[model samples]
Target: MSLYQTSPAVAEALAQGRPVVALESTIITHGMPWPQNLEMARTVEQTVRDAGAEPATIAVMDGTLYIGLTDDQLVALAQAQNVAKLSRADLAACMAMGGTGATTVAATMIAAAQAGIAVFATGGIGGVHKGAELSFDISADLPELAQTPVNVVAAGAKAILDIPKTLEVLETQGVPVIAVGQDALPAFWSRESGIKAPLRMDQPAQIAKAFAMRRALGLPGGQLIANPVPEADEIPADVMLPYITQATAEAEAKGITGKSVTPFLLQRIFELTDGRSLKTNIALVLNNARLAAQIAQELSALP
Candidate 1:
């Protein structure tokens, strides 16, 4: 039996050489509350479609890797409790145990590559946690981008992380971090992280050409397109900084570590911002989906 399965829409699109934008399922299962999560998932998928690309939302259900989900499956996943958040280290284990899992950036890239999808869109990528010098904690997403051949379009690393160190790690891994329409790296929820991006490409065709060029050169990894959140929806860096600092401090005081830290910080930030953070998250994800669809369309036009 094949380990992977694709929804009819995604399969048809792939077979027909059409543009398809891969989506991560963590946002549905772990990023938000029930009905809203389901709503967000549908909206994001539709956003990709509206941009002239098919959407493939990846996940693992009963040991089977689903390249895209059916409506019923999306509902079940949104309502499912305690779904394992799968990443590079435990994705296989979750599958072996027949557990349902939400794909993180790393796992999503792995799945997208396996399914031959060239682009993915997400709210943000995980990165070096604050105070990583002591915890030595870093997200596998960085290393995955260094090896996986999927172009990831995100608002940038989550604002709660150490954005500067994350960029350094990406640079060290020989990954291309391209900022779209701007020279500054976007800190998730904010339009600018204040650290200049190493590369900037204004057009989707430019990003597509870079991807093609990398493949032609036999580069192992994918590129990170740091698309900024729409300015109307962004929470300026200065306004977000204190909230992030407080949330990080709270997490540390509570001894929240590993995978728990991000969710905790996000929830706390949501509270601290009077629910504004979640709204910003949704806005940024939609922005990324739009850009990813454009990039996928360009890539599909390539030879």
Candidate 2:
């Protein structure tokens, strides 16, 4: 792998042993519309800062991996058409070929671990898509988390996926799923998945200690801190189920699959909910960012 050049701000933070939270880039390019996406990207980064850490949002431009983007780059990327969505399988290819790409959760984790940033914040992790039993359409995120040593804070698996199966896969792969301040695993956009988390940690310091212990034990995989969305911001599982079913059915009817499926489903859900989903999504991501920053701070305190 080519040496990744960390941004000046991120480099200094790492050198000083200050907390740094890594962020994925697909949310900016594939998850939202232009101006709003750019605004949300900046807001998420600022939230991490407000919570006492620097945010390092990862992406690729002309094959160079960037730890953080300048304002102009963020805006241009948000509005740019035809950007590649990079994941574990394709990340190296993009960098090697000198192509611009947005980092997904899997790619972000790889970059974060390489940069020595132990914590990452994202809206949600991808998982076993519905009908994966037949389609075999699982996300690379599972294996990425199974090997990379980053502490990922997310609202849980995206609501569009099969939550139980996703949890099962994570368990089988030996990744820790620790719920923050809750017993039930959270479903993105909703506060409850009605499934209890395998592990629970109420304090960021406790979670940080867990990561430390994992390293001490020579564990290979990372940890997934499943932080639930704030109650006021949640859509509730019941209220969201029918909408998700309808959106999934529509996607199937249109034969949208693979990389196109997620964006299509999210857009359909946004239209179906009159943009409430997007609003809830933004809230959940910011909440996750705040929690990730706190965890990063805690981790930084470790020897």
Candidate 3:
């Protein structure tokens, strides 16, 4: 039996060798609430379509991994509660148990590669959390990128993570961190992280060529393309830092750890920012979707 199913649209696109961008379902299941999550999902997918690539929004429903969700399945996943957030560690177990779950970056990349999709877009990749020395709480995303052959487009690591340390980890793993059109990496809700990005590319085609070259060289992993949010939509690193600090402190104080840390900090930051952070999150995600689509288009055109 097949372990997964592709939506008709995604199957057609793959068969035709058209560009298809992989999108994660965690944003719908764990990143936002209700109608807004559904709306963001729809908007992000449409943004990819407008930019000339098919969007494959991946998830697992009742043990069946889905490469792309239809509208009804999208709505159902958006509305589903207590959904398991599946990462590399738990994705197989969730599937084995006949469970419903949303794919995190690691799981999404695995699913995308399985479906033969080459690019993925998300708000931000998880990274080495603050105070990770004692907790050892690095995200599986870093390791996944070192092995998965999919280009992941994001604003950057979440602003709340230890950005410098995150970069250190990515470098150690031999993953390319390419910031688009900038010298600095973006910090999720903010457009700048104040640290220099290791590499920079100015255009989608530039990124696409690098991706293809990596494959030609028989490289094992994908590159990370840090696509900054639109300037008008960014919260500005300086403006966002204090709120992030406060929220991180609150999470640490309240004993929030592991997978729960990100959600907890984000909610607290959302409240502290008077909901501005959420707006920025949505904007960055849409921006990443657009870039991922263009990159995918360029990739599809490659020999």
Candidate 4:
């Protein structure tokens, strides 16, 4: 028996050598609430399709690594309670145990590479948490980018994280962090991180060329393309910083540690921001999906 399963849409696209954008499932399961998650999932997949590529939404269900989810599967995963959030550490373990899981950035990249999908789109990737020097609570997504060949597109590190430390860790791990259309790194929910991007690329074709060249040179990891949310949809960084600071402080006070920290912070920010953060998050994710599809198309057009 095959170790994985592929949906007909993805199988057809792959057979034709067509471009396909890999989407992480955690955005559906853990990123948003039920009906909204389903709505976002459908909208994102449609966004990719509209941008001229297939959308491969990855997850593990009943011991099968599904490269692309069918509509019913998408609905099931979105509404399922207590779905395991799988990362590099336990992706295989979940499969072996016949458990269902939504893939985080690290797990999604691994699944994308295994399926020969070269591009992934998400709202943001996890990064070094605040006070990582003491807790050392860094996310596996950083190291996964250092090794996985699938290019990931995101708004930036979640504003709730330590952005400078995340970038520093990625730099140390030899990951290419490219800001799209600007020199400033984008903060999730905001168009600017207030920190200059280490690298910048203005076009999808240019980004595609870099991805190809890295593969040609046998580079181990992939690129991080930081695509900012549309200005109309973004909240300024300054407006969000205080909320983030407050939320982070609250989490520390509550002793929220490990994997629970991000979700807890996000939920608090959602409340603090009067749900505006989630709206911006959805916008950025849609923007990223569109960009990732263009890159995938550019990649498919290449040799």
Candidate 5:
């Protein structure tokens, strides 16, 4: 069985040594409702293309690791029910068992590295969850970044998580936490997280150089590029805090745990925000896609 399959556009780009950005499929399957998910996926891919790179959206379908999806495949995945949420732990096992799954940030990074693509774009990555000290419910995304050599571009850890603890964990693991165009780390739907980013890069090319230098120096892991949501699209951290706190309290009261916690909180927050969070999510994802493409282009230009 083929270990992976690349879409025609991605294959051609690889063959021609052009820039290619990998995208995770979980946002389509688990992050949003149907038609909007489909629309966002297409728009993100087009944004990368418009920025002079090919977009390779990775997923596992019927035991195949797809580096990119055809239009029909994308629609099918978006509308499909009960898609497995894949990560580093179960990616190959799911494929070996001929299961269908949507890739998360961690799984997408692994897939991108396997496919020789060095950059990935997503809305936000999972991190240390609230009450992690008690529940020990850290995200696989952190460990995946510790080992996978694929640079990830995102808004930040989802604002609903324990952002301070997330930063501390990243520090302990020595993962590069970079804020793009600012000194403050970004929260997913908000422009600021009120925490200082360990590093700041004002240019996409500079960020690309940092990735290249790490590789050249035989570094094991990749960098995290935290790009803030556009100001006009932001929900503002102060305004969002109360809603997140209330939603998190509800989760704790109901004993929501593991994978269910995030989606639950997100859905509750959505209801609380009257559906504005999803709109910001789509915008930030598109922004990350554009930046990831530029970084990929710069990497391609490097010796």
Candidate 6:
């Protein structure tokens, strides 16, 4: 059996050296409600195509690692229950056990690198949870960025996380967190985190060149392109802070830990915000998809 499977469109694109952006499946399987999740997945994929690249949504189904999903597969996975959330530690094990799984940022990067894909887009990355000093619950996504050579475009680390500590961990891991069109790192649903980014790039071509230069210098890690959510779609940081704090407090009080923390906080925030948070999330993800497509195009054009 082959180590991976690819949809016909993605396979053709890869064979022809066309631009392709890898998408994570956890956004579909674990990030949203059933029909909304499917709709978001479709929208993000179409966003990539509209920006002139193929979108390869990665997932594992019945023990098979699929580099891209068909339409039916997307629908099935969206409505599937009890799907494993796979990251670096459990991705292969999920496949080995013939279990269906959704790919998190770390797992998606691993699959993207394995399939020779150079770019990925998502709403946000996991990061140091608030109070991680004692909880020691840093996310796997940070270390994966330090080692995987796939450009991950996102609004930024999820605002629910400890943004300052997240940046510190990224810096310590040697991951280049480059804010696009600004110096301030974006705070997922908000455009500015008040934390100055260590690096900034104004254009996709500049990002592409940096990516190539890193490879030339034998750098093993990928870059994080922090694309801010469009202004009209964003909830100001001040407006979001209280909702985040309330949700975080709820999660802690409920004793939610491990993989359960993020989804729980997100759901609580969604409720606390009267559903506005989910809308902002969808907007940011689509925005990242467009930027990731542009970066992929530039990467493909490189010699």
Off by over 4 Å in 3: none
Query: What are the Cα lDDT values of the candidates?
Result: 0.95, 0.93, 0.94, 0.95, 0.94, 0.96
In model 1, where do residues sit more than 4 Å from their true spots?
none
Clash tally for model 6: 0
- Model 5 Cα lDDT, one tens digit per residue, 1-303: 557999999999999999999999998998888998899889999999999899999999988999999999999999999899998889989999999999999999999998899999999999999889899999999988888999999999999999999999988987999999999999999999999999999999999999999988998898999999999999999999999999999999998999899889999999999999988988899999999999999999999
Error of 4 at 151 (Å): 0.6
Model 1 lDDT tens row, 175-211: 9999999999999899999999999999999999999
Q: Quote the lDDT for 112 in model 1.
A: 96
lDDT per residue as tens, model 4, 15-34 = 99999999999989888888
Task: Quote the lDDT for 50 in model 3.
Answer: 98
Native-vs-model 4 lDDT? 0.95
The TM-score of predicted model 4 comes to 0.99
1 or 6: which has the higher lDDT?
A: 6
Q: After superposition, which runs of candidate 2 have C-alpha atoms over 4 Å from their true positions?
A: none
TM-score of every candidate relative to the true structure = 0.99, 0.98, 0.99, 0.99, 0.98, 0.99
Q: Which residue pairs show backbone clashes in model 2? A: none
Instruction: State which candidate has the highest lDDT.
Output: 6
Off by over 4 Å in 4: none
Q: Estimate, for each residue in 106-225, the C-alpha lDDT of model 6 and write its tens digit.
A: 999999999999999999999999999999999999999999999999999999999999999999999999999999999999999999999999999999999999999999999999
Per-residue accuracy of model 2 over 25-96 as CA lDDT, tens digit each: 999988888788899999999999999999998999888999877778788889888889999999999999
